[model samples]
Target: MTSQVEKRLAGLGLELPPDWTPRGQFLPFRKDGVLVYLSGQICEWAGEVTHTGPVADTPEGIAAAKEAAKICALNLIYRLREACEGDLDRVDVILRLGGFVNCHSGFPSSPAVINGATEVFIALFGDDGWHARTAVGVSGLPGNASVEVDAIVRLKD
Candidate 1:
């Protein structure tokens, strides 16, 4: 059966990726009690880094970085689904999100870029998706991807 979260994703014209394998020596997500901690996900799809290089502070750069951030969020959602045993409806709340934007030193638009991921969660989970977040510019990221995001989620009993 399709979960409500899946339906919401369809309504938003989005779908989770088919598969995601961690590229490093870490689990994609770790569960502790009712909380699931998701590792960072970059803007990679089908094994290809979609957005490489540091983001510039221009309109086009921000826009592209935003899209990259969205991709990262989708990937994180994929891991979240796995952690929830393929039932996203089991999610109680998105507790927090940590976003990193690969950009030049002192880039001021990291928050704007990370909003891409925040919007996705809100669209999919409504009030439950609202989360505390930290968005920061970084000199570099793994895979040289433009954006990466990690999450913490609470699960319903």
Candidate 2:
């Protein structure tokens, strides 16, 4: 069967980089029966973080960070599909998402910010895309990047 993850990536002109090892002895993903918990993924590509600094400090950068979050979600999908032997449809429920905005205390727009992933997930998975999500502002992100996101997806029967 054709992988929508692969085809969508091609349509979007992107390719998932290899799995990234977690910092401090942490693992990136853990599966229990039918659900997979993916550790938070930063908006970095090839070890290079696309942007940094708080949204209040960097407006244009914040806009870019929103776009980057969506891309990060796509990358997550690719990794999940690869792990499941190339069947994205086997992903029955993309149950939850947690997004981080590496921003200062005054920064706002978190819901719209996380909409980056929300929008993409819907486009990709249709009604199955609905998910519980958290959009949080933090003092800083692991790599000082402006955004990061993680997910929990329930595998199909």
Candidate 3:
């Protein structure tokens, strides 16, 4: 049966990425009791990195970062689904998210760039998606991705 979360994703014209492999030597998510911790997900689509390079305030850079953030969110959602055993309705709460943006030294718009991923969760889960978040600017990220996102999620006990 299609889960409510799946329905919501469909409603948003979003689909889970086909591949959920970890980008490096780590599990995609680790579950402890009811809490599931997701590893950082870079902006990738169909097994290819979608965006790379430093984020700047320029219109093009911002647009690219936003797109990258969205892709990371999509990847994170897929991990969330996996954590729930393929049933997104099992998600009880979205606890937190940490976003990292590769940018020029001292860039101040990391939060806005990470919002691309933040907005996706809010759109998918509504109030339940609201969570504490941290957005940091970094000189580089694994794969040199423009944005990387990690999430903390809760599942029904």
Candidate 4:
């Protein structure tokens, strides 16, 4: 396999979760004319939930959710690239994303934390780096993970 994604992960010094799971019926991504719509994803490693509390807003929140968001971005890269047959270079735009942070009260910087994902996208995609996004503070999220992300990407055909 060509190493666009593996190289990206190695450059970041990160490992795949070995267990990121999709909680819903929808497929993780759908492609239509250079657009990839990613399903919502949470921090699951080996079918187990991590960051099992308020995301980025509590003392117990895993520092890794932010990191996980970065990882998720990597996962997104592979998702899109693989969908297009390893053509990440054909990626044209990030259409939208709904950022869900499962947090308790007093979560002051959820946006900042989610920026971990945002930064990774910018770094990886460069000019195709920005998207319409919503960062929401949710009472709870599936699997009780601290953060979850859903994205829509547009690419070159």
Candidate 5:
């Protein structure tokens, strides 16, 4: 049976990718009671980095970084589904998101870039998707990804 979340994803023309294995030694997600914590996800798909290098601090750079953030969101959604046993409807709420953007010093648009991920969750889950978030500029990230996002989710019992 198609879950409500799956239906919503279809409505948005979004498809989750196949199961992903962490390239590093870290776990993708960890569950404690009803909460699931997702590790940081970058803008990579099918084993290729969609966007590489530190984000530029120009308008065009922010736009590109936003797109990269969206990719990271998609990857996070994929992991969330896995954490939910393939049923996203089990997600009660998105508790928080931590966004990191690799950029030059003093870049002030990290929040704008991370909004790409936040918007995706809101589109998917409506009010339930609204989450506490921390968006910060970083000197570098793994693979030099433009953006990386980690999430904490609460699940329905």
Candidate 6:
């Protein structure tokens, strides 16, 4: 059966990628009670790591970083599918999102970049995707990715 999320993705011309493969010791997500905590996902697509390096503070440069942030959101969507056992309808709400941008020194627009990810979720789940968020600039991220995002999701009982 096609999940609601799958249908939503289809409408957006997107599809969930394969099950997330953890690159390190930590699991991609851990569930406790009705909540799922997702680990930080970097900008990776189709086995290729995209959008590396520090984001500049210009319009064009920040746009590129925002695109990277979108990719990270897609990665989280796939991982969320796994956590829900392929049934995204079980998702109750997106509780929170934490975004980190590998930005140039003095760059202060991380929240703008992270909005790329936030917008996607809102499109997919409507108000259920609206959540608390934190966007911050960091010196660097693993694999030098331009953006990374982690999420807190609540699932239906």
The estimated TM-scores of all candidates read: 0.98, 0.87, 0.96, 0.80, 0.96, 0.95
Candidate 4, lDDT over the whole model: 0.68
What is the C-alpha lDDT profile of model 4 across 29-120, one tens digit per residue? 88777678887777566677655656655434546667656655655665666676765666777777677777777677677657767877
How does model 3 score by TM-score?
0.96
Give the C-alpha lDDT of model 2. Answer: 0.76
lDDT of 3: 0.90
* Candidate number that wins on lDDT, 1 or 3: 1
What's the lDDT for all of these models?
0.94, 0.76, 0.90, 0.68, 0.90, 0.89
What candidate 2 gets wrong by more than 4 Å, as runs, is 57-59
Candidate 3 per-residue lDDT over residues 1-157, each given as its tens digit: 9998889889989888888456689899999999999999999888788899788788789888998999999999998888899899998889999999999888988998989999999988889999999999998998888999999999998
Candidate 2 lDDT, tens digit per residue, 1-157? 6777466656767566665555446666788899989878877777777767465545566577788788678667756776576788788878999998888786777766778877778777778889999998888887787788899999987
Candidate 3, residue 28: Cα displacement in angstroms equals 0.4
lDDT of 5 by residue, 26-72 (tens): 99999999999999999888877788768888899999999888889
Cα lDDT over the full model 1: 0.94
Error of 1 at 92 (Å): 0.4
Candidate closer to the true structure by TM-score (higher is better), 1 or 5: 1
Model 3 error, position 86 (Å): 0.7
Deviating ranges (above 4 Å) for candidate 1: none
Inter-residue clash pairs, candidate 4 = 19-46, 28-39, 55-102
Model 2, backbone clash pairs (residues 3+ apart or across chains), number? 0
lDDT of 1 by residue, 7-36 (tens): 999988998876856789999999999999
In angstroms, how far off is 21's CA in candidate 6? 3.2
Model 1 lDDT at residue 3: 96
Which prediction has the highest lDDT against the true structure? 1
